[model samples]
Target chain A: MTSWLPTLQTATPEDGYDLAVKLARVAVKATQPDAAVRDRLRPEYAEDADALIAVSHVVATHFATVAAANNYWRNRT
Target chain B: MTSWLPTLQTATPEDGYDLAVKLARVAVKATQPDAAVRDRLRPEYAEDADALIAVSHVVATHFATVAAANNYWRNRT
Candidate 1:
């Protein structure tokens, strides 16, 4: 099957945001050396599983905001 | 050199912030398909060189804020 992925050229803010979210997840996992740490990282925002996903969204939003600001400044100049 | 880096067990908010900034820089570089694109990413904040560095700070601050919030929530639970 042909892959739908596009060739690498440059990342738009959206792409940066998506990548940031993925990287954050990896970093979080790297931080967790044991079940205790993983359990501690769990959120009270929602259910245990849902909380973890929400954390991803929170980090993603932060990244997307910065990426948008970067793009805005890039366009301005 | 001792490298001074600690083993990865858990990340503090500061660690997350620093890692976010570095990862963002890599992602930005990966996004550049050509010299022109790289040039365009150049900022006009201070001087050309300073502007680029400032961009990292901006993104880092955002990451730090989110990380702090995450920690707060994690602790609360």
Candidate 2:
């Protein structure tokens, strides 16, 4: 498998945000390689609002990390 | 802001997975527009294992939906 953690680079904050989401998803795939199991368990949390909010929270954390890693993508020429 | 629910299309399963992640992020942004507020709350869920797991659960749910929408990106001759 490819490296789970790749070098962070983005041209814009939106791209950084997108990369953050990718990181979150990559972390998930790394933890759970079984797609069938993940699919089977989806319904348990799919409709739960709190669970969904947790998703956003994790993504936000990732976005923050990615933003900081790129220095908020500042000073771009 | 762009449409949160953009038309989903992907050339491969990986891209589809990326789109699923995007969808998850868009959902979050749509629900919460305040970046500072989200950043403030990030630490609460960032270190919580259960909260992190919930992120995967939600992503899987979104992946399942995207996979179905794209017919699993199968039979691409």
Candidate 3:
């Protein structure tokens, strides 16, 4: 979308879900912040860091679960 | 992926992300629980229902953020 946020790669749904998790993690990296993105998300983020932090975990777990499911199926074949 | 879980439609990354949110909510539907999934996710979910409920919101919001971006580009064209 906008050039500000880190982009999630999307080769396929399965792969994209996995990538979104990674992108979110990168966005929250302690060492570096995308200035434009920080400005863009500032309002809600300043108000609710807890909620934003919580999702970084949830979406990561959700994608992992989906990835694990794919692995489970691939092994069956 | 499995028949037991709600399937996400995957055409592209942008669209798939949106669909993932819908699938998650469907999986958590109050009326019908996916028996197989409930069993699979029992350990974590049984321990904490709050986080799972919260991701249902995050992923949805994340998808909407992306969709708005796509529209932002489309409108400019």
Candidate 4:
């Protein structure tokens, strides 16, 4: 599938970067047990569900990857 | 301090982004407990240890945010 985060035509690199961060923030709010915060982040994905979901998956995997890498080196040197 | 990944002067948006993914991959390889792969990723962190470390932290936190956000809404709606 096409890249949802990087390929948006009208989005500047800065915009895309900011959006990535926004999506990242929303992702964290997603795992919370609270309904209100979840409600707040809903609009981001509501109109473009598929793209948002795809972005979410990429963002999640990316996070897991980097976190593990940083921790690995942290212990070694 | 300045942003690590985004602020790299020579980096294109695509390059900065690809580097982000590379960092993530390196992060995962880091947790493998395998010496060889860890050796491989060390060069990435070697010269600009401060910037690479900064990028790692941001990537980690961003990933955490998005993953949690995705999961929260996944269960609810």
Candidate 5:
């Protein structure tokens, strides 16, 4: 098996977001390792508005999970 | 204007990924604040394979950006 996750950490909200995106991608790669397959499928959704919005929802879900983990990035100076 | 980004910090890669997803969603929300519009559009993409894959790509792109910020989480014990 491949190592999908590394020691996760972030210093800013932007960093957190970037890591979240990576995690999402890593999940997809784990589910489907073939890049060609993903590439072939990309165009279909790329142009669709509905698909784009759906993507945002997925990202948001991931973000919420991350926020919980970091306690919403609270308790810092 | 809505503040999409809060003080970001993560303690694990998973946390970072979650934040990344949140960032992506925040971007979308910023672009389109109307929740009803996003909800209506989600189903169309949710059921489509291409759209789903596209979502993964978007997430991956975000991850890559995050990874760079964290130096690929490289220098940590």
Candidate 6:
């Protein structure tokens, strides 16, 4: 039971996508206990899947780039 | 990233609810390994939230009724 549960209980199908995205963000927190990931979802709370997916892609890409940079540093050293 | 990811990637916002519902079912399976709950979601896979909420209400009502019945039987004995 979340703060959004009441709204979800009352939302129309047109609004269901937004509600579902909110639930999905909550579900991600509920599933993945990673604080960093949780932080990523917070500001994006009102965002739809397109926005969330785009942010996720950015986060993942940044992480991959960082990892690649570290690997490059290790190889150089 | 399950079998539905490909479809989700391509689905319009109109289809996102159904897709999100599908993902929610998979997520419940992924999250809750309870076979009985899993079974409940299975038959209702294609159902929308309205349909799911209805079935869930029915199941909960039936469960509560059975529990009440058992309590009554015990009290009588």
Question: Highest lDDT: which candidate?
Answer: 2
Model 5 per-residue lDDT tens digits across residues A1-77: 77655545556555666566566566767788999998887656554565555656566556555655655556557
- Alpha carbon lDDT of residue A62, candidate 5? 63
lDDT of 2 by residue, A1-77 (tens): 66343345567999878876775667565445567755654676667787667767767766765566567667887
DockQ of each: 0.03, 0.06, 0.05, 0.04, 0.14, 0.01
Which residue pairs show collisions in model 2? none
- Provide TM-scores for the models: 0.31, 0.48, 0.30, 0.25, 0.49, 0.24
Task: List per-prediction Cα lDDT, in the order shown.
Answer: 0.44, 0.64, 0.47, 0.42, 0.61, 0.37
Docking class of 2: incorrect
Clash list (residue pairs), candidate 1: none
Candidate 4 local lDDT, A24-57, one digit each (tens): 5432332333566445445644556664565555
> Candidate 3 on B1-77: residue-level lDDT in tens?
44432323234566658654653443233212345543554455435667566765656655544443244235432
- Assess candidate 1 and give its lDDT: 0.44
Instruction: Give the DockQ of candidate 1.
Output: 0.03
**Candidate 2 TM-score versus the reference:** 0.48
Better by TM-score, candidate 5 or 3: 5
**What local lDDT score does residue A40 receive in model 5, on the 0 to 100 scale?**
83
Could you tell me the lDDT of residue B65 within candidate 4? 43
What does the lDDT read for residue B70 in candidate 1? 45
Enumerate the chain B TM-scores of all models: 0.41, 0.80, 0.35, 0.33, 0.77, 0.35
How much is the TM-score of the A chain of model 5? 0.77
The superposed Cα distance between candidate 6 and the true structure at residue B63, in angstroms, equals 30
Tens-digit per-residue lDDT, A4-39, candidate 1? 324222234345455455555556676776767766
Q: Across residues B1-77, which tens digit of lDDT does each residue of candidate 6 receive?
A: 23233312212333433443343333233334466754554555435565455434333332332233233234432
TM-score of chain A of each: 0.40, 0.78, 0.34, 0.33, 0.77, 0.34
> Candidate 6 — which residues are off by over 4 angstroms?
A1-77, B40-77
Where is the poorest 10-residue window by lDDT in model 2 chain A? Answer: A1-10
Which candidate, 1 or 2, has the higher DockQ?
2
